[model samples]
Target: MPKKTEYVLRLYVTGASPNSIKAINNIKSICEIYLAGKYALEIVDIYQEAEVAKKEQIIALPLLIKKFPLPEKRLIGDMSETEKVLKGLGLQS
Candidate 1:
């Protein structure tokens, strides 16, 4: 049997901006529907924790990083594009 994959995701946002809020909500919804009990999500507010963003080399306001399961993936913007985000995370809609 194949080993189950556990997803480790990091979301970097700047304060409570609309794009940031949208990204957070979208990712949470996706995780609940797809990753459910097998995922760890860390939401980082760059405005409050600038060092984290700098250390992660975040260039965008709302960025999603899939840190686990090898070949880490990154998604930028508001994360409103569900299909694209899902594809980036190697998941089917």
Candidate 2:
């Protein structure tokens, strides 16, 4: 069988803020339900990794970057909207 396409996701957020926490939970839930074992998620706290944030050029507090599978995409928000998140991740039409 062919291997499933693996997704690489990087979530950048500030320290423990409400929006950051919400974005984490929301993205996790989405990944569990949709991406399942086919995704690698990396959460980066700008406070702890300022250099990473600088390198990534993150201007927003809560940002989700789909780094793998080509055509990299970015979404910025708390990620409360499931449909929007799904669409952003290329899981929905």
**What is the C-alpha local distance difference test score of each model?**
0.89, 0.92
Error of 2 at 20 (Å): 0.5
User: Residue pairs in steric clash, candidate 2?
Assistant: none
For model 2, state the Cα shift of residue 59 in Å.
0.7
- Among these predictions, the greatest TM-score belongs to 2
Best by lDDT: 2
Model 1 misplaced regions, further than 4 Å: 1-5
lDDT of 1 by residue, 15-64 (tens): 89999999999999998898878888999888888787768888977999
Q: How close to the true structure is residue 39 of candidate 2, measured as C-alpha lDDT?
A: 91
Q: Identify the runs in model 2 with alpha carbons over 4 angstroms from their true place.
A: 1-5
Q: How close is candidate 2 to the true structure, as a TM-score?
A: 0.91
Model 1 scores worst on lDDT over the 10 consecutive residues at: 1-10
Estimated TM-score for each candidate: 0.88, 0.91
Model 2, 1-93: lDDT tens per residue? 654759999999899999999999999999999998889899988899889877888898799999987799999999999999999999998
